[model samples]
Target: MSLTSPAPPGGGPLRLRDFRLLLAGAAAGQAGAQIALVALPLVAVLVLDASAFQVGLLTAAETAAFLLIGLPAGAWTDRARKLPLMIRADAVRALAMASVPVAGAAGVLTMAQLYVVALVTGTATVFFDVAHQSFLPHLLRTEHLVAGNGALETVRSSAQVAGPGVGGGLVQLLGAQLAIVADAIGYALSALFLLGIRVTEERPEPVPGASLRKDVAEGLRFVAGHPLLRVIAAATGLANFFAAMLMATQTVFLVRVLGLRPAALGLVLSAAAVGGLAGALCAGALGRRFGQARVIRLSALVSAPFGLLWPLSYGGAGAVLFAVGSGAVFFGAVVYNVAQVSLRQALCPPRLLGRMNATLRFVMWGTLPLGALAGGALADALGSRAALVCCAAGLLLFPLPLLLSPLRRLRDLPATATAVTAVTAATEDPGRAGGTPGTPGTSGAPVGTEAP
Candidate 1:
């Protein structure tokens, strides 16, 4: 298939064979990931008898690669074909996950092994995610980007809706060790599906005298210099920081503080994901109705207050408060993510797609490890409920960056980076003439949009 050609107009990217394959692979991979999200911590808590801080350390390990290799991964991804890189990532993740079950069967499973697997898989994910986002523009037209992203998010959300339930059931029926086997199988299936994509991409043309450091710096400059991107990055980074705290401590809180079993815990998570699913379903329409830029701020403003419900949750019917709060927060996050990510993809230049994504991810996701450590340490120092209170307060503060930025005044984001820069220049110096704005760049669209 030709890389320059667009999918047939009508029915979105779903009608394309290659897109279908990609979506199928995403479905497989996301389902497994959701399962591991539940089973991994369960293994640490249930089998290894990990303490609160140890569980936080485990969560930090899973995301530390983003801080360590995030920038260079983007440079490498831009230098290689994305499909093969994604396949290799899936293979690595599958193998890593498979080792857990094998080691458990051999009576040698330990926190050390889990940490190694988390680090290895997290490194692979950095590459896979950068490549996946960079590859989409080659497969579909600019107009299809939002729809394509929405479709992928829909499958992911659906998996979140069901995968945790299945994982919990598996944990109850089979041991947590054996339950992880499902994640390995899912990655294997994802790899197989990726192999079926027939689209061929030419190798990226290397820049003359290019060094990795310079390339990485260029990506950083592009994001940092952009007025809108800076605000979006700040908001997202703060949100992820607090979200990471929640991730690191939520299992410990639910399992110990609330006294929930594995099965009940999964159901609560699944229930919370319903909001993400709804947000995915409504994102495209919301963007159309409320302008994407406006929606971004509105989503955050609406969701911030709901976070207080988490620390207030208690046993029995009051537990529903936690689920509702989480659901409301997730809904806002998904909507905010879909709008901002699509805007980012639209604005970036073709050659800089990989670097732009990588830079943004580094800025946004790099805080995860720090947040995890803080959550773990805080939980150990204070009680788990106290830690939850801190995270909830942090969540309320996440929207401050957006509310204070130019996004608050704009209805829709400009379609191109050139336009954004031009507008900024015009606003700063009213006497000078800025160039005419350009249309949205058709370089690439985002896939695997950030999870909250």
Candidate 2:
């Protein structure tokens, strides 16, 4: 049964109490996530004295869930209650994070433990993120997705800005083992906030004759049959691939090639995060002005060139140049994300949201582990500076998939239920004669195959 909910009275989500709680939970969770992102590696490197290979392995573990269970997890979420599932995932992550500090204090914490914690938390995160995205459409209307996403993105960016500094300081003051306690505490707080939400969620209806394999196929078809989604998936996948390469090598590069300490690295990341915040803040306005689809295309054009600058940093003041390049890259990427994600929420049917998001994540983020491993191998073979140059060049091509798609020609996109329904129909219906070339209103697809 659908909740007898009225359309939220005001434009912004802040007017809704339940939305506020949801945002708060996300804020707390992301803050903890950012802290852990920095703290976990610090513990591995500084405390346990892990090697570059170990750190690369740890990085691969962090995103391995995307490849392992990213597909079926969406089907599971589609059947389960999103709010309760998210809450439980948070609790699981909290326990995992807390265990790290306990083992560290006992002087038994090992690099093995760090990898386990990363994997555990990462698995939990995959579920939380998919459920969270699925839950938002229920909480807000399609129109508010940009505003809602922007607000949430701002919180996320702020968390990243503050979290690194906070994580670094805690590591400095207390041991890395103790610093991780803060991440555990943050997850606990997120659960508490989620518990405070009053909105009632209707249980998901089970798909008749649904097997995991069949359900996963449904999602894959949903994305692959459409042009815009397929292109977006490819673009994001490329970005993740190169970004993972950077992730696999950046820490080692910063520490060895640039000779920077952890604290300085934290400040640099914080500086880059400020650009993300600014991009989030500007997303809605940019969407309204340039058209959402145009913003996405333009964002790639603006951001990809700056990636070339990252390979040029020398040392000392060059770190400032590095931050500037990274910050600009982040700026364009965040703006692109805000527009594209909002478009998707508006595009997908409610029943398919979980699976759609999961499929997209699987397609886009599944590349991370591969990229991470490739980056590590590249560094081992070619050295960090050369690896950085190669990855930076790779980043320049991330926008190609989108540039060659119908999305590049669009001025706006369809977000109404009728339009999305039509688009879904075009994908599933075989007799539509290739479905009007995937342009908006041309048989309801953003892109599709040419007819004979």
Candidate 3:
């Protein structure tokens, strides 16, 4: 279906037409992107004969863009129409990816070029992700927020499960550079589809005389001070820190330590994706049965211990056990992510949505580079096995801050009055009460109405 139109007004479950199209677009793009990510490294290793340290450096380069550009991108997103940002990002990535084949064909492809392409594409991705998320609340009724976010999570999980296999297959059949062509095509297709959907974004219209810095600062302050936001920033930042470390080391551990073939790696990764999908699907039910905060806390608790299993794989029956453990950890991550997004959207004010997203992402995503660098360093010094163990242990301790915070006790989110009061108390700034970062006016809205 055409994706250019806003979701139909009669929003029900995520089965709505525009919603499905949106999900489809996101999935296609993600599947292709994952394939590219996997293929790029394989190309580096098998084709270019890069070492483990080199691969780690590539991953570090890719994520460095998020660290450098995420915050400013958020500011730009707050002032811009989010959809356009997504579209442009897709377009830019498509072009960047398509360049891989051209460079390879010319016998000019080099490790440095690949690193540059990865970094540039990733930088574009940061903006696209921020805008895409910022666009979600406008697409459905506030009450449907959790379910909608769940749907997106399902797509992402499915991509994780399937994308790697496709990437590996393409790499095997068509060569890694050619496989990257699929990712380029996916981005182009995503942009074409997204271009069809129309959205009425809620950007703050430029005042007769407002400075860009002031506008950006306003968004930053909201995140720095908001109650739920403060907790979310802290929690997600830690989770990402450990996750990045794990990701940096996972390939090495699986291939070298566990002795898994590329095909087996795909299957194992797919299993984790399946588990993650299940967790996303169950998030809403769990939230309804328990409380949102309770679900978040429980998921964190359950996921943290499973991370330790990664280090246990020494190639025999250990491989099987590690795969199962990885699936469980991924499952919990999916659940936690869905719940977190829903909570943020529900708590954030409309006007400050872009800034809030940017701020949170800046803080959370900033850990990726550090984690990548540390992961490489740890592996070099202590071996991949030790590095995996360290990351797993780190995961266990990651949630302690969240669990000890007031976020653990938060139940049904307070209405506007109490929410505003909380925000005011948190920030010690009364002027913020009526503006963009204030408590949303609606009661009984979706818990994450402002989350993007």
User: Using TM-score as the measure, which candidate wins?
Assistant: 1
Q: What does candidate 3's lDDT look like per residue over 110-162, in tens digits?
A: 99998898888989988988887877876766777888999889888878888
Model 3: runs farther than 4 Å from truth?
1-16, 200-204, 417-452
lDDT of every predicted structure (CA atoms) = 0.86, 0.80, 0.75
Rank ordering of all candidates by TM-score, starting from the highest: 1, 2, 3
Candidate 1 residue-wise lDDT, 210-299, digit = tens: 989988987888788778888898999999999999999999998898888888888888888898899999999998888777899999
lDDT of 2 by residue, 1-452 (tens): 15445348666778888889988998998898888777787788788776666777888988999999999999999988898999999999999999998997787888888888888988998999999999888888666777888999989988978887788777777867888888998899999999998877789777678888987888888788765688889999999998888788777777678877777777777777787888888988888887777888889888877766667876787887677777788888889998888776766667777888999999998999889888888887888788889898999898887777766546666533344345445555636434432333212323232221
TM-score of 2: 0.91
Highest-lDDT candidate:
1
Kindly report which residue stretches of model 2 are placed more than 4 angstroms away from their true locations once superposed: 4-7, 415-452
Model 1 residue runs over 4 Å out of place are: 1-5, 416-419, 422-452
